[model samples]
Target chain A: GAGVSQSPRYKVAKRGQDVALRCDPISGHVSLFWYQQALGQGPEFLTYFQNEAQLDKSGLPSDRFFAERPEGSVSTLKIQRTQQEDSAVYLCASSLGDGSSTDTQYFGPGTRLTVL
Target chain B: DQQVKQNSPSLSVQEGRISILNCDYTNSMFDYFLWYKKYPAEGPTFLISISSIKDKNEDGRFTVFLNKSAKHLSLHIVPSQPGDSAVYFCAASRNQFYFGTGTSLTVIP
Candidate 1:
């Protein structure tokens, strides 16, 4: 089966520009999550979605960050007015069951974004 | 604050030897723990997981041991192969997931 996948493996944008990163979860996955990983650091939580409903957005760092999963399959993480601090690898993960502690997350290859 | 922490940044082990990676967490409420492995330029892949109820879980060459009292977990790999060389991340979840700084493992064949 195909695992979670993210598009635009690499992206370079100027500061104050807008960027969108896409993620395609597994066929039957009901839960999706986004994370940001800085250099030499572990991934930090960004946001979460269950089906088409956004469950948690508390992890989003700033108001410029936004995410949506309208059809319950594909998700997009959009950043308005990109900053150099946002230069990190954005990762997407999905699970077959609801976003619970027991469900193991399958991660995508991640999209590396660089803001200059 | 980092809820989950991997104190060691890197470790090297000889092939066919045992590789042990350790992790600690501040949250005792974490009910489930997982390990992930990653190569450069790739996202992490789930390796093994253990529930809070069980003290240990084993999968082939990989084994995860959890100590609830100590708020610690360890991953042990036996007969480590060169292919096992990668960064290992420890994650704990209550409702959301908290990941540890990864430990880079180098298996010399």
Candidate 2:
């Protein structure tokens, strides 16, 4: 079975540039999530999707962050006007259920985004 | 505020010995807990999990313990192996997930 996967293993952007990271969830995953991990720190929640519908996005750092899971299988996290603080690894995970089940989340390799 | 915390930044244990990693959380609403392991240049892989209803759950040599009243959680690996060396993360979730800073475990053979 294919695991969750993120594109462009690494990305470098100018401070004011916009960048988009992509995630491909498992074939039948119902729940998807995005998290940002800073160096020497834990991963912080960013947003969540329950089959194309954005659910909890309380963890997004600011208005510059946006996520969408249009087809419910693939998702994208877009950041506008990248900041130096946005330099970190963007992780995506997917689970078999809508989160009510004990199904463990499968994480993607992550895309390291660096803002210069 | 850090809702989930792993106070120990690192730990070293001899192979074939018991290794314990601890975690604490400030939130009581967390109903599910999970442990993840990661190597450099890779994403975290789920190791084990325990629900609020269960006090303990075991899988092979990996065991997870949960204490609701104490707001504490821990993972114990019996006869830890050298291959077990990696960063372990503690996570709690209900609707969203909160993760700990992670503990680096080194198993010396």
Q: Residues A1-116, candidate 2: write the lDDT tens digits.
A: 58889998999999999999999999999999899999988888899899999988998999999999998889999999999999999999999987653767889999999999
In candidate 2, list every pair of residues with a backbone clash: none
Q: List, residue by residue over B1-109, the lDDT tens digit for candidate 2.
A: 9999999999999999999999999999998999999999889999999999999999999999999999999999998999999999999987778899999999999
lDDT of each: 0.96, 0.94
Fraction of true A-B contacts recovered by candidate 1: 0.85
Off by over 4 Å in 2: none
The DockQ-based CAPRI class assigned to model 2 is medium
* Candidate 1 Cα outliers beyond 4 Å, as residue runs: none
Clashes in model 1: which pairs? Answer: none
